[model samples]
Target: MTFSIVARSGQALGIAVASKFLAVGAVVPAAEAGAGAVATQAAANLRYLPQGLALLRTGVPPADVVAGLVAADRERAHRQVGIVGPEGPGATYTGEECLDWAGGRAGDGYAIQGNILTGPEVVEAMESAWLSSPQEELDRRLLAVLAAGDAAGGDRRGRQSAALYVVSPGAGYGGGSDVACDLRVDDHPDPVGELRRLRDVHELLFGTPDPGTLLDLSGELKEEVQSLVAERGYASLDMWVGVENLENRLVSGKIDPVVLARLRDAAPDGK
Candidate 1:
């Protein structure tokens, strides 16, 4: 019913998933900063989420974690799980009783898995995308992997939900939590594509401004900024930015380049 990847990128870890199931994010993906991440599906045992992370936190290897979790469950044969621990390579498991098109793969720093998928090619495409882009940030990398699986025919039953979740120490909003990126498309005809759009908006709203891309706040640029905010009845650019909860991206009195683009896109008549 789902295809997911559990992975690590430097100090951050994440899970990206799409499924025929509603709110797959709430059930399948779980992770902790500096600990590990897991994808539990195919009659997913939610208990494996906390339990797997606990094991990984206790220095249990990912392979052993998979072993111990299934061993303890009376319904092991109906479960499928993947784990990437605090260190080393990742691990994956598929129950004998899982749906006809279910399987998984584990490798360096990541694991890719799915159930009721089109075929093995779904996971194969995911693995290829994950490996091909070793240098992307964690959130982007995981999204790319999920997108590949989606393109190859994820969840033979069809798509309804998708999610991208990532965590890194002090990476959350204002460095308040472990969650760095969390986006979900709980119900959509093109959930994967919707996820990509949401991810772009997430970056626009929450991502830090790149100094290299900062635009000069003078002349026509400054005038345009003021006009865009006024279109929404705000007298100042800062007011609109604050109202939109984009103050973080408005650094040092300068608006983020993406925010400016967004303003232009939102303007009436494409002004």
Candidate 2:
């Protein structure tokens, strides 16, 4: 019922997921910065997420938590799970009673799990794609893995929703917003594809630019700026500023006397 990426940042770890079920997020995953992440699915026990996270917060290992939860659950045989904890602790559990072909895989840094899926091969494809995919940012890499799973078969019942989230101390997820990107496709023809498109827009706005923001000018910097814009097929300050999308209030036809004198004094040639 869920697919998610859980990751650590400066002082936090984030968990993001989506599913057809209502508030599937509340049921399928848990994450903490110093602790770790866990995904419990297939007749999912929603309590496991918070309980698992709490155990992890106490420095318990991910495998142990999985084992403990399985031991306590009477229906453990029908469950599917994936866990990754601090320092590379990872594990996956697929009970025999789980619906046809249900299973999961755990890797060095991630876990892929699914149930009532098209087949065991679906989870296998997810794991392979995640491991072999070109190295990229966590969200992008994760989307690729989910996309691969879908292509391989995915949930036999069909897809419904998708989500993405990341937590960082200062880096904005998109366009300087404090929250890194938090997006959802609750209902879509191709939910994962839609989420991927949103992530692309996030990168365009937040990703580092190929050409750095640089400013260089000859003669009086302000005047040179003015002159350069005018030479660039613009007629006046208004036209230059308009083409550059600079606010008009920041400049005028005549520099204020004080500002003009300061610029003149600062200029090497004292224009």
* Candidate 1 residue lDDT tens string, 126-145: 99999999989988888889
Error of 1 at 192 (Å): 1.0
Error of 1 at 42 (Å): 0.4
Candidate-wise lDDT, in order: 0.89, 0.63
Number of the top-ranking candidate, with lDDT as the measure? 1
The regions of model 2 sitting more than 4 angstroms off are 2-23, 168-179, 205-271
Candidate that would win on TM-score: 1
Per residue, candidate 2 scores C-alpha lDDT tens digits across 1-271 of 5544444333434444545555455467655545677777788877787888788778777788889988999998978777777666467788898777677777666767777777778777777776676456666767777787778777677777777655444545333543455566677768778878988866643454322332233357657646544455555446543343333222333333323233334333222
What clash pairs does model 1 have? none
Candidate 1 TM-score versus the reference: 0.93
- Candidate 2, after superposition: displacement of residue 265 in Å? 39
